[model samples]
Target: MNQSNETTMNPPLNQESVSLEPSANLVRTIAVRERPANPGAWSNTVAFGWRALLKIKYVPEQMFDVLVTPIMFTVMFTYLFGGALAGSTADYLQFLLPGILAQTVVFTSLYTGVTLNTDISKGVYDRFKSMPIWAPSPLVGAMLGDVLRYTGASIIVVLIGLVLGYRPEQGLVGVLLALVLLNVFGFGLGWVFTVLGLILRTPGAVMTISWLVLMPMTFVSNIYVDPATMPDFLQTLVAFNPVTHLVSALRGLMSGGVTLGQLGLSLLTPVILTAVFGPLAMRLYRRKR
Candidate 1:
């Protein structure tokens, strides 16, 4: 006799009897939120500016030069050559402070390009290029952030000078105006370094080239000595040096003798430098690999 076994199967659960709490971590429907509008160029620029500020915050050592160099120059020159140059330390400081302020800002401006070149070398600019923000915002914002650095350096130089018995004849207003002018010229001069940053392969190279350009500009100008005391040929060369005019303007502003011609001359080179290098920098930035 053959025996057959029957297999029993349970009925499927009824859909009506099934229950799931609304609190369950399961979504039965999809919801879409509206996308926010894109940020404007100014917003983008400010954001990048904040980023630059953050770098300074995190790497406070970045300010070492800004703080130390001005102090060194102010103290060293004030004492070393003070008696020979101007008869007394106090007297020399009065003559030197304004020029030191200008020199400090010009020197500090090189860091802008050094920073840009470092970022580019490390591929930060590549990411920036991929972002949806305005193209020049990074460059503009970095320089804007640097304006604060310039201001800080200036304040340090001024304070040191004040401590050393240097007094501004025009008082607070003159000092403030001089600072404003210094920053404006620094902003314009920064584009030259920005262009260097784009073209140079390394931050070191940018720094080297910047120093090469800066040494002659700062030393040959009326920063340390009166151009009138130099030989006639040297005096003529100093007269044409943009830094010479800037130093003169700054001195005049602080000491209460600035003229319209001096102010105009001080601004002329910066205006021309910005006009020429600003476009050149943009072009190089856009085409940079």
Candidate 2:
């Protein structure tokens, strides 16, 4: 039959109409795109986070560093500088534990960059490129993972101090508050390091940079000494140093004399850090990815 005549013969059913409701067959015909357009970005973040956790599961040492490194630092500093700083070992441990815990948390944040660099070099993140995961997840997830490190590190140091008879006059609540501040402060620092690691070329380079960046921030703070004891310029620096505020806040709480200035600075530093670093990390992370 001629094609024109065949079409004309089939056109007679104008009175009947077909409806278009969504159905399996309709979807198959109309919605054949291979991947979702938006790709459920939040869910992808959760997935990426879960993946990092799973990787950490296979290597427990990723977590153990938090417990061990901080403890070692606390012990070393207490014994090494205790004699000069305080009259006796017992007195030093009590006076020094909180500062060491703060220092430990700051030092502990360095590994965020190192491990993040390790993952990038090992092609661990290459898999992420091919997946639907949100790009910010790895950077953020790594930071979150290290919050555990901060908490664990603080707890270990505090427990060791406790066993050594480093009692806080503020008792249980102070101790708990100290741990909370440590983790929050350290978590913000992790974001800073995590951003640096993602952009840095190598783990060793990241480590070197971490030391350069962290030392001044840690030492200039009131971590191990009172600001009044330092030189005038340094005392001013220590007075304004965020870590010092954190240490002071924790110390004040432990010693049962919370000052408005310490409390204000203590609350502000971590919030400022995370607010500043959070966006920077996300931006750098997206660029690198």
lDDT (10s digit) by residue, model 1, range 85-108: 999989999999999999999999
Query: What's the CA RMSD for each of the models?
Result: 8.5, 10.2
Top-scoring candidate (TM-score) = 1
Provide the global lDDT of candidate 1 against the true structure: 0.90
Clashes of each: 0, 0
Candidate 2, residues 157-212: lDDT per residue as tens digits?
Answer: 88888877789999999888888877878877787888788889989999999999
Q: What Cα-based lDDT does every candidate model obtain?
A: 0.90, 0.78
User: Per-candidate TM vs. native?
Assistant: 0.87, 0.78
